[model samples]
Target: MPIAPAYDWVAHHAMVSPDRSAWADIDSTGDGAGLACNWREADERVGRSAAMLRDDFGVGRGDRVVMFSMNRVEFIEVQFACARLGAVFVPVNWRLTVHELDYIVSDAAATVLCADPEFGDTAAELTQRTNVPHLVVFSGAGSHPEGSVDYDDALAAAANRIDADPALLPVMPELTHDDPLTIMYTSGTTGRPKGAIITHGMSFWNSINLAELSDLGRSMVNFCFLPLFHTGGLNCYTNPAAYFGGSTLIMRTFDPGEALDLINDPERGITHFLGVPANYLFMGQHEKFATTDFSGVVTTAIGGAPSALPLLQMWEKVGCPLIQAFGMTETSPMVTSISKEMAVRKAGSAGLPGMNTAIRIVGEDGNDVAPGEIGELWCKGPNITPGYWNNPEATADAITNGWLHTGDAAQMDEDGYMYIVDRWKDMYISGGENVYPSEVESALFDLAGIADVAVIGLPDEKWGEVGQAVIVKSPDAAGSVLDETAILNFCRERLARFKVPQSVRFIDELPRNATGKILKRELRG
Candidate 1:
């Protein structure tokens, strides 16, 4: 197969189909605040913003810009603008703390920072610490700091026409297949976050695969509620939607009532939807869920955590089959996905790998494991990241030969279906957000009277796995009682709110192995 040369997503969309609906923000509150833009409008905004960035903000090719915001129309527009300018886009997870946020911004060396009103306070704090020259506030409603510029104001100042000098402009670069496009910071499980360097070819190939696999094209309508910062949302929703010229219903935040209303309405044209198990669980429990008609839903992809059998059954009863999938940020996020044809047969499996993607279960010695035997999941494909940014040692350890070592314990059946058994890393995913045990442990260490802490995941009815911290306090701290609120408050300052432990238990001592390693398995009991 001849490899197609790389092209920026914005350039590709503008050249191919300029009038198709590229993105839209659905009004979850039923207000008229919803925003929608077709491909032409999206291209114009990106072009205008690119020109403004070059002339006003001094951004050019190879420069990095950080976009910190929730799931909104502007979030997608900023990404397009970055691509148009040939600048590497770094999207910060909005839930991260000031410390984590500052680390990523500095690491990316972002010359320009764009933020939504909700994150203005954190952005203001970051601007004080970094040499970022420009700050553009989105949503048009925020009180800007003294030096910041309004996003709408910048767009207004931009020329309506694209500049003639394509080479002098940012989008004219000859983007090779391997050239870096986006640097996504993985939700670090054990230590500080690592930036996964993604290329134009890798992202484009994954989007094509997803579009073909999910039967998404110009005729399909996709409802995207996942955060664009995550691979699941970007590759699956935004990229694929652009690839097929399909319409997308975007939501800045996931609301059960609003989601139900959108899916049930026939005019919404929602044929496909994707979310984690927690989303399905929450929607399943909503009072209107049972009454709402989901007959129009063709496919619903559920992942992040295992989907409970009961939840699957509930969706099936409403004529919507749930397909479970398994992937990580490193593999361009799509490894194995449950196919619609095998939806009922392979109830728990994450299906087989897509075209040209290989999956294997390897033991400690790097040999393949037998069928039905548990081992670390390893993947090799065009979609896999070349390596983690600026971490050669870690990258060497992670990618053996060409296979990306996924720190997930999984089993494969005789028919080649993969089933997730457990995670090798001590990472708990609550409501689709990756919560690292080390990050939570570091926060717990700051508590004044804390002696030792071990954080583990416990099965929950809503969130697939809620964080449970078992603390062993000092002898003098025996009389000190620790509650959920106190421990959560302590974490809020150092970590994201989602990473905070939902429950805290004061134990005399945590189970430790002979080598003094905290035994999380025993702690789970």
Candidate 2:
């Protein structure tokens, strides 16, 4: 029989490649115990977990179960269990505040929440206000909160005997290509967050595209350090790696030194790595950076923020080309990427659209713009999301005529190479002249004493809005003053006079949302 389009990867892999290594987690703490699981073990655990969800917790088809934890072996197992049982998995960002977590749980209508002990306090505060009926704690050495179930104990309570027939579980409904599979909440850099409804087909298609685009075969082992709650980490890396029968070296949390150690480890056989630019920046500056060997890694995917040209050059100096990609949680997180070959030639451009994708630049009048003219980027593809979970007005506004309006202003060259200017909402008009923050941020990146910088428009009575550059000075440049004159002088040489920042403020760090994207909304405030 042919494999179903809505195939369960855990079930398929267990049947086909039972003995293959599926996932490995290194204990960063000095416990001397690491976690490893093969396809067979993963499938059994997921199945047993699913039975527990059904029999014990009363979780079944169409129910929402939220997983609040960092990267761990059980996270993947629980995700698979949810998938197999036709339940929706909502992975909450552990970094969110209690109020934020409460809002999401209430908004998503998640009935069950599986949390790690590390977040017990946050979960306790949220559960008090929300309607969450069940709480299961995993990987915690501490006592469980009252009315909460221990994850390991729950799993053990379920009979260890496998289901009589692997296919006997409830068949996933005849889902349209657009039916919701995962509801990933937006990072909410601008305002209140909304859940982006990712469909089963969207996730599966993007994973297939990524596997083919990156040439990820069975022998490849991918490194995942980005939070699994984010689309780039979950759909792009973990889900896809499982689809192709490849292995994933799961990092519970992102740490530059630990990541470098994992990359240099010969036993892990890590061939593919993906991370945000901040990770590369830290790793490149580490004391042992030069001596670390990355000859085994064939591809390094970097995104989530604009990488400095200097940082890319630094990685190149170490014999690795960081392929830049651009996508949001709404795009199934794989919209466009700079191919390995083009990474050298096009330093900052997020390369052409992937297979089966269409990209166009539209002006305020909703028509395509000419080459080199900045306009809002709109994308349409199988991978593009149908709409936000609820909020029809927002959905209608974001998706018009079947194209997902990206809200990012960009320009494309004659050869179809695209360059991101800035978010449409982020671009400010000063003195009747357009100012893209990315332009100023790029220039700031070249400055000697800058570690990080974000440009925002401050309320100005004269120019309507004046540019304010908020900077985080490098550790070496600490205790030194970075006055507005110095920044203005630096920009005067690189940018037009009107585009230069009118004011400069020294900050410890730019504010960022859960996904690590700079929160200009907070910065403006």
Candidate 3:
């Protein structure tokens, strides 16, 4: 396949629709608004920002430029800038501890570290330990070391040196679609964090894949509240809008009422967005949710986890249908998605594969399973990541014959829609019977008095392992009435004997990662 030459899509959109809005940064805390740049201005900002990175930071081709900042419009600027320079942009989770980030910075050997003002001290400390060559305060420059670059001053200087409207990487014409666009690190729950190399090809394919499934076009206004550090944030709708000439409403961070405010506002014209189950749960439970009119909103996707029936009904009542999607970081995070029409008709289903993507449910024997049988889900497409960065061994283990082993247990129904059961690794055998915790959790959701629940396999005296239920009781549940015996009996009536939990442990809350996925590893103790 012939690869397209190196370039940025922002430039093309700017030329085609110069005056159209490309990005709108909404603070959501105060007036609930910020910078709203049209295509022409956004393109100029990206060009000058790229120049600043190249000239001031000495950033170059193949170098890693790691950014540690909250959800701001500058993320788009820096990412596109890196692409313009033939460099790789790396966005780290702001919620991650300094020690956790140190591992990623050192692993990537990041040349230039850019961060928001609040994290300047953390960035400085990282620089000290990793001894990174350069550091730049991404947005506002606070009391940091003198050598650090301020994002605004650097861009102004770059504008003075470069053309008013500049051409990006005219000399590096050989840069192609397969070149590294970003190195997104996976949530290192199981082991060490592996940097998934997201290529320019995957970015384009994801946009095409999303467009194929939904009405994401020039007029699309994507409301982005998810963290840009994750694939769901960047590739989900943010990057797709950039590719299709649509504007993105970038929020500083997630705030339920604040989100409702923007979604309800007619002027913002927020059309499409993506969120996890927890996001919808909160938004639905919000006092303002009762009045949330889905008139301006077209499609808001759900991922990270499956949506419960009540959660699905909550949005359905308000006229917004939750399009449940399934994917991970390595696949550019888009594998399958259900349509709004099938939102409840096929509730809990991940729906169909994208036009450019293919999926297979392979059983333990490495053969395709019959329509309703659960098996490991494997994905292949232009959207799939090539492999992990600097970890060839890990890469080789992840991909086989151009197919990414998604490690997700799923099944395809007769209608061709896929149902993601649970993580393949999360499945445990009880007395030789496979037990998917998600299945148990879903069943438990139907039971009253249970606020939240997670099931894990524990060592057993006779059976190889037995299911253990870690639960959070609803505040209204009468005391002692919802004890271990009652819960076990409730499961016994619903689940197979082997699937029922042998023991129950109640907790105030369930531990979750940034994306709201229950931390099973943390629960194992």
**Who wins the TM-score comparison?**
1
TM-score, cand. 1 vs. native: 0.94
Sort by lDDT, top down from the best? 3, 1, 2
List where candidate 1 sits over 4 angstroms from the true fold.
1-3, 28-33, 160-170, 475-485
Deviation in Å, model 2, residue 445 alpha carbon: 32
- lDDT, candidates in the order shown: 0.79, 0.77, 0.82
Which scores better on lDDT, 1 or 2? 1
Candidate 1, residue 308: the lDDT equals: 75
lDDT of 2 by residue, 256-342 (tens): 888888889898889987777667877887877887899998878887655668878888877788888777788887878887777
The per-prediction CA RMSD against the true structure, in angstroms, equals: 2.5, 10.4, 10.6
Model 1 CA lDDT for position 173: 60
Which ten-residue region of model 2 has the weakest summed lDDT?
161-170
Worst 10 residues of 3 by lDDT: 164-173
Residue 10 shift from truth in candidate 3, angstroms = 0.9
Off by over 4 Å in 2: 1-4, 28-33, 161-176, 188-190, 427-525
What lDDT score is found at residue 58 in candidate 1?
Answer: 87
Candidate 2 local Cα displacement, residue 442, angstroms: 29
Clashing pairs in 1: none
lDDT of 1 by residue, 103-163 (tens): 7788788889988876787788887777677788775454467678777777776753344
